[model samples]
Target: MPESATLPSATTKLEYLRKDLEDLRYYLDEFSAFLPL
Candidate 1:
């Protein structure tokens, strides 16, 4: 099997996942701010 077929695509997917997680955290924080403790 070729190495290029496996590695580069996974890195791209990881980067996308990280961005999505960051956005989710940001929204969660915003929602938390509106709630009474």
Candidate 2:
């Protein structure tokens, strides 16, 4: 019962982290287009 109480917040944190990573990747991809290999 105690573990169930903590699960929602932990899942929300994980979702936020995943969204941050996706946003970071998008910005990096955009920046990389202007750089020459």
Which candidate leads in TM-score? 2
What would the per-residue lDDT of candidate 2 be over residues 1-37, giving only the tens digit for each residue? Answer: 9899999999999999999999999999999999896
Candidate 1 structure quality by residue, lDDT tens digits, 1-37: 6788888899999999999999999999999999886
User: So what's the TM-score on candidate 2?
Assistant: 0.90
Residue 24 miss distance in model 1 (angstroms)? 0.4
Candidate 2: residue pairs that collide: none
| lDDT value, candidate 1, whole model | 0.94
Clashes of each: 0, 0
TM per candidate comes to 0.78, 0.90
10 residues in a row with least lDDT, candidate 2: 28-37
lDDT of 2 at 26: 99
Task: Give the runs in model 2 whose Cα sits over 4 Å from its true position.
Answer: none
